[model samples]
Target chain A: EAGVAQSPRYKIIEKRQSVAFWCNPISGHATLYWYQQILGQGPKLLIQFQNNGVVDDSQLPKDRFSAERLKGVDSTLKIQPAKLEDSAVYLCASELSGANVLTFGAGSRLTVL
Target chain B: AQSVAQPEDQVNVAEGNPLTVKCTYSVSGNPYLFWYVQYPNRGLQFLLKYITGDNLVKGSYGFEAEFNKSQTSFHLKKPSALVSDSALYFCAVRAAPGGRRALTFGSGTRLQVQP
Candidate 1:
Protein backbone atom coordinates (compact mmCIF):
# COMPACT_ATOMS: atom_id res chain seq x y z
CA GLU A 1 0.00 0.00 0.00
CA ALA A 2 1.21 3.50 -0.74
CA GLY A 3 1.85 5.92 2.06
CA VAL A 4 0.17 9.28 2.44
CA ALA A 5 1.39 11.81 -0.13
CA GLN A 6 2.08 15.53 0.33
CA SER A 7 3.19 18.16 -2.16
CA PRO A 8 5.70 20.99 -2.14
CA ARG A 9 8.03 19.33 0.35
CA TYR A 10 9.17 22.82 1.30
CA LYS A 11 7.73 26.32 1.07
CA ILE A 12 8.82 29.81 2.03
CA ILE A 13 6.70 32.95 2.20
CA GLU A 14 6.75 36.41 3.69
CA LYS A 15 4.52 37.23 6.66
CA ARG A 16 0.93 38.05 5.69
CA GLN A 17 1.31 36.06 2.48
CA SER A 18 -0.88 33.04 1.68
CA VAL A 19 0.10 29.42 1.15
CA ALA A 20 -1.54 26.07 0.70
CA PHE A 21 -0.41 22.45 1.14
CA TRP A 22 -2.00 19.38 -0.37
CA CYS A 23 -2.31 15.82 0.94
CA ASN A 24 -3.45 12.54 -0.51
CA PRO A 25 -4.28 9.87 2.01
CA ILE A 26 -3.69 6.15 1.74
CA SER A 27 -6.07 4.17 -0.40
CA GLY A 28 -9.34 3.12 1.25
CA HIS A 29 -8.62 5.04 4.42
CA ALA A 30 -11.69 6.82 5.73
CA THR A 31 -10.31 9.13 8.38
CA LEU A 32 -7.91 11.99 7.72
CA TYR A 33 -6.05 14.37 10.00
CA TRP A 34 -3.90 17.46 9.73
CA TYR A 35 -1.32 18.30 12.36
CA GLN A 36 1.08 21.17 12.92
CA GLN A 37 4.51 20.49 14.40
CA ILE A 38 6.58 23.37 15.57
CA LEU A 39 10.34 23.28 16.01
CA GLY A 40 11.34 21.24 19.09
CA GLN A 41 7.74 20.17 19.67
CA GLY A 42 5.41 17.35 18.85
CA PRO A 43 2.67 17.46 16.25
CA LYS A 44 -0.57 19.16 17.25
CA LEU A 45 -3.87 18.23 15.72
CA LEU A 46 -5.19 21.03 13.52
CA ILE A 47 -8.22 19.34 12.02
CA GLN A 48 -9.80 15.97 11.50
CA PHE A 49 -12.27 14.59 8.99
CA GLN A 50 -14.25 11.43 8.93
CA ASN A 51 -14.78 10.90 5.27
CA ASN A 52 -15.71 14.27 3.74
CA GLY A 53 -17.40 15.69 6.83
CA VAL A 54 -15.33 17.41 9.50
CA VAL A 55 -15.13 15.63 12.84
CA ASP A 56 -13.09 18.22 14.61
CA ASP A 57 -11.42 21.59 14.04
CA SER A 58 -11.28 22.93 17.57
CA GLN A 59 -7.58 23.63 17.42
CA LEU A 60 -7.54 25.17 13.99
CA PRO A 61 -7.21 28.94 13.87
CA LYS A 62 -10.26 29.56 11.72
CA ASP A 63 -9.27 33.16 11.18
CA ARG A 64 -6.13 32.12 9.28
CA PHE A 65 -6.01 28.38 8.85
CA SER A 66 -8.56 26.31 6.97
CA ALA A 67 -8.63 22.72 5.71
CA GLU A 68 -10.94 20.62 3.63
CA ARG A 69 -11.01 16.97 2.66
CA LEU A 70 -13.13 16.95 -0.46
CA LYS A 71 -14.65 13.77 -1.82
CA GLY A 72 -13.32 12.07 1.29
CA VAL A 73 -9.97 11.36 -0.33
CA ASP A 74 -7.51 14.24 -0.68
CA SER A 75 -7.13 17.19 1.65
CA THR A 76 -5.87 20.75 1.44
CA LEU A 77 -4.68 23.00 4.26
CA LYS A 78 -4.41 26.70 3.64
CA ILE A 79 -3.01 29.50 5.72
CA GLN A 80 -3.82 33.00 4.60
CA PRO A 81 -1.83 35.95 5.90
CA ALA A 82 0.67 33.51 7.29
CA LYS A 83 2.30 34.53 10.50
CA LEU A 84 5.81 33.80 11.77
CA GLU A 85 4.23 31.43 14.26
CA ASP A 86 2.75 29.53 11.35
CA SER A 87 6.18 28.39 10.21
CA ALA A 88 6.23 24.70 10.95
CA VAL A 89 5.91 21.27 9.44
CA TYR A 90 2.38 20.33 8.40
CA LEU A 91 1.69 16.59 8.55
CA CYS A 92 -1.21 14.67 7.10
CA ALA A 93 -2.24 11.26 8.39
CA SER A 94 -4.94 8.73 7.64
CA GLU A 95 -6.33 5.56 9.17
CA LEU A 96 -9.18 3.21 8.64
CA SER A 97 -12.27 4.00 10.59
CA GLY A 98 -12.17 2.39 14.06
CA ALA A 99 -8.44 1.68 13.66
CA ASN A 100 -5.98 2.83 16.28
CA VAL A 101 -2.88 3.51 14.20
CA LEU A 102 -2.41 6.30 11.68
CA THR A 103 -0.15 6.37 8.59
CA PHE A 104 1.56 9.71 8.00
CA GLY A 105 2.93 11.59 5.04
CA ALA A 106 6.49 12.94 4.77
CA GLY A 107 5.03 16.38 5.58
CA SER A 108 5.28 19.90 4.14
CA ARG A 109 7.72 22.25 5.79
CA LEU A 110 6.71 25.89 5.65
CA THR A 111 8.86 28.87 6.53
CA VAL A 112 7.20 32.22 7.14
CA LEU A 113 9.64 35.09 6.95
CA ALA B 1 -8.79 17.09 27.81
CA GLN B 2 -5.99 14.62 27.04
CA SER B 3 -2.27 15.36 27.30
CA VAL B 4 1.16 13.68 27.44
CA ALA B 5 4.45 14.55 29.06
CA GLN B 6 8.03 13.69 28.12
CA PRO B 7 10.07 14.98 31.05
CA GLU B 8 13.41 14.61 29.31
CA ASP B 9 14.27 16.81 26.38
CA GLN B 10 16.87 14.25 25.31
CA VAL B 11 18.31 10.92 26.41
CA ASN B 12 21.86 9.73 25.74
CA VAL B 13 23.01 6.12 25.80
CA ALA B 14 25.82 4.07 24.34
CA GLU B 15 25.19 1.49 21.69
CA GLY B 16 24.32 -2.01 22.95
CA ASN B 17 23.14 -0.55 26.27
CA PRO B 18 19.64 -0.68 27.57
CA LEU B 19 17.55 2.42 26.85
CA THR B 20 14.40 3.93 28.19
CA VAL B 21 12.31 6.97 27.26
CA LYS B 22 9.83 8.08 29.86
CA CYS B 23 6.28 9.17 29.09
CA THR B 24 3.31 10.04 31.28
CA TYR B 25 -0.21 10.88 30.26
CA SER B 26 -3.57 12.12 31.51
CA VAL B 27 -7.02 11.74 30.04
CA SER B 28 -10.62 12.14 31.10
CA GLY B 29 -11.53 8.58 30.30
CA ASN B 30 -9.57 5.36 29.78
CA PRO B 31 -6.44 6.20 27.78
CA TYR B 32 -5.23 5.08 24.41
CA LEU B 33 -1.48 5.47 24.56
CA PHE B 34 0.98 5.43 21.68
CA TRP B 35 4.63 5.99 20.89
CA TYR B 36 5.91 7.29 17.57
CA VAL B 37 9.39 7.84 16.16
CA GLN B 38 10.31 10.63 13.79
CA TYR B 39 13.46 10.83 11.69
CA PRO B 40 14.87 13.99 10.23
CA ASN B 41 12.61 15.62 7.63
CA ARG B 42 10.16 12.75 7.84
CA GLY B 43 6.76 12.07 9.27
CA LEU B 44 6.18 10.17 12.48
CA GLN B 45 6.27 6.39 12.34
CA PHE B 46 4.18 4.28 14.66
CA LEU B 47 6.27 2.46 17.21
CA LEU B 48 3.70 0.90 19.52
CA LYS B 49 0.37 1.45 21.19
CA TYR B 50 -1.51 0.33 24.30
CA ILE B 51 -5.20 -0.09 23.53
CA THR B 52 -6.03 -3.05 25.72
CA GLY B 53 -5.17 -6.67 26.61
CA ASP B 54 -1.53 -6.77 27.72
CA ASN B 55 0.06 -4.03 29.74
CA LEU B 56 3.25 -4.52 27.70
CA VAL B 57 2.90 -4.03 23.98
CA LYS B 58 5.61 -4.82 21.41
CA GLY B 59 5.89 -2.84 18.23
CA SER B 60 7.99 -2.22 15.12
CA TYR B 61 11.78 -1.84 15.13
CA GLY B 62 12.36 -3.86 18.32
CA PHE B 63 10.64 -1.33 20.54
CA GLU B 64 8.17 -1.92 23.35
CA ALA B 65 6.24 0.15 25.85
CA GLU B 66 4.76 -0.68 29.23
CA PHE B 67 1.40 0.79 30.06
CA ASN B 68 1.01 1.56 33.74
CA LYS B 69 -2.54 2.50 34.54
CA SER B 70 -1.88 3.31 38.17
CA GLN B 71 1.10 5.43 37.34
CA THR B 72 -0.52 6.89 34.26
CA SER B 73 2.65 6.27 32.34
CA PHE B 74 3.69 4.49 29.14
CA HIS B 75 7.45 4.32 28.77
CA LEU B 76 9.27 3.09 25.66
CA LYS B 77 12.08 0.58 26.19
CA LYS B 78 14.63 -1.18 24.03
CA PRO B 79 16.90 -3.85 25.41
CA SER B 80 19.90 -2.78 23.34
CA ALA B 81 20.18 0.63 21.80
CA LEU B 82 21.28 1.03 18.20
CA VAL B 83 22.75 4.13 16.59
CA SER B 84 20.07 3.87 13.96
CA ASP B 85 17.44 4.09 16.68
CA SER B 86 18.46 7.67 17.35
CA ALA B 87 15.50 9.93 16.60
CA LEU B 88 12.76 12.02 18.17
CA TYR B 89 10.28 9.98 20.19
CA PHE B 90 6.80 11.31 20.86
CA CYS B 91 4.23 10.02 23.32
CA ALA B 92 0.60 10.60 22.54
CA VAL B 93 -2.71 10.01 24.28
CA ARG B 94 -6.43 10.25 23.62
CA ALA B 95 -9.54 9.41 25.53
CA ALA B 96 -10.87 5.98 24.80
CA PRO B 97 -14.08 5.25 22.85
CA GLY B 98 -15.53 8.72 22.68
CA GLY B 99 -15.45 12.20 21.27
CA ARG B 100 -13.26 13.22 18.34
CA ARG B 101 -10.42 10.73 19.00
CA ALA B 102 -7.68 13.15 18.04
CA LEU B 103 -4.37 12.46 19.76
CA THR B 104 -2.67 14.95 22.03
CA PHE B 105 1.10 14.60 21.79
CA GLY B 106 3.91 15.43 24.14
CA SER B 107 6.71 17.83 23.31
CA GLY B 108 8.92 14.90 22.23
CA THR B 109 12.21 13.52 23.50
CA ARG B 110 15.29 13.21 21.30
CA LEU B 111 17.23 9.99 21.77
CA GLN B 112 20.93 9.91 20.94
CA VAL B 113 22.64 6.54 20.82
CA GLN B 114 26.42 6.57 20.50
CA PRO B 115 28.57 3.75 19.30
Candidate 2:
Protein backbone atom coordinates (compact mmCIF):
# COMPACT_ATOMS: atom_id res chain seq x y z
CA GLU A 1 0.00 0.00 0.00
CA ALA A 2 1.09 3.53 -0.69
CA GLY A 3 2.13 5.81 2.14
CA VAL A 4 0.79 9.25 2.91
CA ALA A 5 1.87 11.82 0.32
CA GLN A 6 2.58 15.53 0.70
CA SER A 7 3.47 18.24 -1.75
CA PRO A 8 6.25 20.84 -1.90
CA ARG A 9 8.84 19.12 0.27
CA TYR A 10 10.20 22.56 1.22
CA LYS A 11 8.92 26.13 1.08
CA ILE A 12 10.23 29.59 1.91
CA ILE A 13 8.16 32.73 2.38
CA GLU A 14 8.57 36.16 3.80
CA LYS A 15 6.89 37.27 6.99
CA ARG A 16 3.24 38.35 6.48
CA GLN A 17 3.02 36.25 3.33
CA SER A 18 0.44 33.51 2.93
CA VAL A 19 1.25 29.85 2.30
CA ALA A 20 -0.52 26.55 2.06
CA PHE A 21 0.47 22.88 2.20
CA TRP A 22 -1.31 19.85 0.85
CA CYS A 23 -1.55 16.27 2.05
CA ASN A 24 -2.93 13.09 0.50
CA PRO A 25 -3.38 10.32 3.00
CA ILE A 26 -3.10 6.61 2.46
CA SER A 27 -5.99 4.83 0.84
CA GLY A 28 -8.86 3.70 3.05
CA HIS A 29 -7.65 5.69 6.05
CA ALA A 30 -10.50 7.28 7.97
CA THR A 31 -8.69 9.73 10.23
CA LEU A 32 -6.28 12.52 9.31
CA TYR A 33 -4.22 14.92 11.41
CA TRP A 34 -2.05 17.96 10.89
CA TYR A 35 0.84 18.76 13.21
CA GLN A 36 3.42 21.52 13.41
CA GLN A 37 6.90 20.49 14.48
CA ILE A 38 9.29 23.23 15.40
CA LEU A 39 13.01 22.63 15.34
CA GLY A 40 14.24 20.65 18.35
CA GLN A 41 10.68 20.08 19.43
CA GLY A 42 8.03 17.41 19.00
CA PRO A 43 5.14 17.80 16.61
CA LYS A 44 2.18 19.73 18.00
CA LEU A 45 -1.32 18.90 16.92
CA LEU A 46 -2.95 21.61 14.85
CA ILE A 47 -6.10 19.83 13.80
CA GLN A 48 -7.65 16.42 13.45
CA PHE A 49 -10.39 15.14 11.17
CA GLN A 50 -12.38 11.97 11.13
CA ASN A 51 -13.80 11.47 7.65
CA ASN A 52 -14.42 15.09 6.69
CA GLY A 53 -15.66 16.05 10.15
CA VAL A 54 -13.30 17.81 12.50
CA VAL A 55 -12.60 15.82 15.63
CA ASP A 56 -10.41 18.37 17.39
CA ASP A 57 -8.81 21.71 16.61
CA SER A 58 -8.63 23.37 19.97
CA GLN A 59 -4.90 24.02 19.62
CA LEU A 60 -5.13 25.58 16.20
CA PRO A 61 -4.39 29.26 15.85
CA LYS A 62 -7.71 30.49 14.61
CA ASP A 63 -6.36 33.93 13.77
CA ARG A 64 -3.62 32.70 11.43
CA PHE A 65 -3.97 29.01 10.70
CA SER A 66 -6.73 26.98 9.15
CA ALA A 67 -7.12 23.44 7.77
CA GLU A 68 -9.71 21.43 5.92
CA ARG A 69 -10.22 17.78 5.04
CA LEU A 70 -12.77 17.79 2.31
CA LYS A 71 -14.44 14.49 1.40
CA GLY A 72 -12.17 12.76 3.94
CA VAL A 73 -9.30 11.82 1.61
CA ASP A 74 -7.02 14.82 1.31
CA SER A 75 -6.26 17.84 3.47
CA THR A 76 -4.79 21.29 3.21
CA LEU A 77 -3.33 23.49 5.94
CA LYS A 78 -2.95 27.20 5.39
CA ILE A 79 -1.19 29.97 7.26
CA GLN A 80 -1.86 33.56 6.44
CA PRO A 81 0.35 36.47 7.40
CA ALA A 82 3.09 34.07 8.38
CA LYS A 83 5.42 35.03 11.15
CA LEU A 84 8.96 34.02 11.97
CA GLU A 85 7.60 31.87 14.75
CA ASP A 86 5.61 29.92 12.17
CA SER A 87 8.74 28.43 10.67
CA ALA A 88 8.46 24.72 11.17
CA VAL A 89 7.78 21.42 9.49
CA TYR A 90 4.15 20.59 8.88
CA LEU A 91 3.37 16.90 9.05
CA CYS A 92 0.29 14.99 7.94
CA ALA A 93 -0.68 11.59 9.25
CA SER A 94 -3.54 9.16 8.81
CA GLU A 95 -4.97 6.16 10.63
CA LEU A 96 -7.75 3.71 10.11
CA SER A 97 -9.52 4.72 13.29
CA GLY A 98 -9.03 5.83 16.86
CA ALA A 99 -7.20 2.65 17.88
CA ASN A 100 -5.12 2.22 14.72
CA VAL A 101 -1.50 3.22 14.25
CA LEU A 102 -0.77 6.46 12.41
CA THR A 103 1.34 6.59 9.26
CA PHE A 104 3.02 9.90 8.54
CA GLY A 105 4.11 11.73 5.45
CA ALA A 106 7.58 13.17 4.86
CA GLY A 107 6.22 16.59 5.81
CA SER A 108 6.36 20.03 4.23
CA ARG A 109 9.12 22.21 5.60
CA LEU A 110 8.16 25.89 5.74
CA THR A 111 10.68 28.61 6.39
CA VAL A 112 9.33 32.09 7.04
CA LEU A 113 11.79 34.88 6.66
CA ALA B 1 -3.75 18.49 30.55
CA GLN B 2 -1.53 15.61 29.32
CA SER B 3 2.16 16.04 28.67
CA VAL B 4 5.39 14.12 28.10
CA ALA B 5 9.02 14.86 28.86
CA GLN B 6 12.26 13.49 27.44
CA PRO B 7 14.86 14.25 30.07
CA GLU B 8 17.86 13.56 27.86
CA ASP B 9 18.62 15.92 25.01
CA GLN B 10 20.97 13.45 23.43
CA VAL B 11 22.35 9.96 24.06
CA ASN B 12 25.51 8.44 22.58
CA VAL B 13 26.27 4.73 22.42
CA ALA B 14 28.75 2.55 20.57
CA GLU B 15 27.51 -0.20 18.32
CA GLY B 16 26.53 -3.43 20.11
CA ASN B 17 26.08 -1.57 23.38
CA PRO B 18 22.83 -1.09 25.21
CA LEU B 19 20.94 2.20 24.83
CA THR B 20 18.29 3.93 26.88
CA VAL B 21 16.30 7.12 26.40
CA LYS B 22 14.39 8.40 29.38
CA CYS B 23 10.78 9.60 29.22
CA THR B 24 8.14 10.64 31.75
CA TYR B 25 4.51 11.64 31.43
CA SER B 26 1.77 13.44 33.33
CA VAL B 27 -1.90 12.80 32.71
CA SER B 28 -5.19 12.25 34.44
CA GLY B 29 -6.44 8.70 35.01
CA ASN B 30 -4.80 5.82 33.11
CA PRO B 31 -2.38 6.78 30.35
CA TYR B 32 -1.71 5.50 26.85
CA LEU B 33 1.98 5.73 26.05
CA PHE B 34 3.74 5.73 22.68
CA TRP B 35 7.25 5.88 21.25
CA TYR B 36 8.12 7.23 17.80
CA VAL B 37 11.34 7.52 15.78
CA GLN B 38 12.15 10.14 13.15
CA TYR B 39 14.94 9.87 10.66
CA PRO B 40 16.61 12.85 9.05
CA ASN B 41 14.25 14.68 6.69
CA ARG B 42 11.50 12.15 7.37
CA GLY B 43 8.32 12.15 9.36
CA LEU B 44 7.88 10.40 12.68
CA GLN B 45 7.39 6.65 12.60
CA PHE B 46 5.54 4.67 15.22
CA LEU B 47 7.89 2.50 17.23
CA LEU B 48 5.52 1.06 19.78
CA LYS B 49 2.71 1.81 22.17
CA TYR B 50 1.44 0.74 25.60
CA ILE B 51 -2.32 0.65 26.01
CA THR B 52 -3.47 -1.55 28.90
CA GLY B 53 -1.37 -4.69 29.20
CA ASP B 54 2.05 -5.67 30.46
CA ASN B 55 4.33 -2.95 31.70
CA LEU B 56 6.98 -4.05 29.22
CA VAL B 57 6.05 -3.52 25.59
CA LYS B 58 8.22 -4.57 22.67
CA GLY B 59 8.07 -2.53 19.53
CA SER B 60 9.40 -2.26 15.98
CA TYR B 61 13.11 -2.09 15.15
CA GLY B 62 14.21 -4.14 18.15
CA PHE B 63 13.11 -1.44 20.58
CA GLU B 64 11.20 -1.76 23.84
CA ALA B 65 9.85 0.47 26.55
CA GLU B 66 9.16 -0.15 30.22
CA PHE B 67 6.16 1.57 31.75
CA ASN B 68 6.55 2.42 35.40
CA LYS B 69 3.27 3.66 36.71
CA SER B 70 4.66 4.45 40.12
CA GLN B 71 7.32 6.70 38.60
CA THR B 72 5.08 7.97 35.80
CA SER B 73 7.77 6.98 33.31
CA PHE B 74 8.02 5.03 30.09
CA HIS B 75 11.64 4.78 29.08
CA LEU B 76 12.65 3.39 25.68
CA LYS B 77 15.37 0.74 25.63
CA LYS B 78 17.29 -1.48 23.27
CA PRO B 79 19.64 -4.32 24.18
CA SER B 80 22.03 -3.79 21.27
CA ALA B 81 22.52 -0.52 19.56
CA LEU B 82 22.99 -0.22 15.82
CA VAL B 83 24.43 2.75 13.98
CA SER B 84 21.32 2.83 11.86
CA ASP B 85 19.30 3.39 15.00
CA SER B 86 20.61 6.90 15.31
CA ALA B 87 17.66 9.28 15.07
CA LEU B 88 15.30 11.50 17.02
CA TYR B 89 13.03 9.70 19.46
CA PHE B 90 9.83 11.14 20.88
CA CYS B 91 7.59 9.94 23.67
CA ALA B 92 3.88 10.65 23.74
CA VAL B 93 0.90 10.09 25.95
CA ARG B 94 -2.89 10.41 25.85
CA ALA B 95 -5.47 10.48 28.59
CA ALA B 96 -7.22 7.16 29.03
CA PRO B 97 -10.50 8.11 30.61
CA GLY B 98 -11.27 10.97 28.24
CA GLY B 99 -12.57 10.26 24.77
CA ARG B 100 -9.80 12.44 23.34
CA ARG B 101 -7.35 10.64 21.08
CA ALA B 102 -4.79 13.33 20.50
CA LEU B 103 -1.22 12.59 21.58
CA THR B 104 0.85 14.90 23.74
CA PHE B 105 4.50 14.61 22.76
CA GLY B 106 7.84 15.26 24.41
CA SER B 107 10.50 17.59 23.05
CA GLY B 108 12.47 14.64 21.66
CA THR B 109 15.80 12.87 22.30
CA ARG B 110 18.48 12.50 19.68
CA LEU B 111 20.14 9.08 19.79
CA GLN B 112 23.60 8.73 18.27
CA VAL B 113 24.76 5.16 17.78
CA GLN B 114 28.41 5.11 16.80
CA PRO B 115 30.04 2.46 14.71
Error of 2 at A11 (Å): 0.7
RMSD of each: 1.0, 1.3
Write one digit per residue (lDDT tens) for candidate 2, span A67-90: 998788989999998999999999
Give the CA lDDT, 0 to 100, for residue A12 in model 1.
96
Docking quality class, candidate 2: medium
Best by TM-score: 1
Enumerate the candidates' DockQ scores in order.
Answer: 0.71, 0.65
Error of 1 at A110 (Å): 0.3
Worst 10 residues of 2 chain A by lDDT: A94-103
lDDT of each: 0.94, 0.92
Tell me, by DockQ, which candidate is best: 1
- Across residues B1-115, which tens digit of lDDT does each residue of candidate 1 receive? 8889999999999999999999999999799999999999899999998888999999998999999999999999999999999999999998987335988899999999999
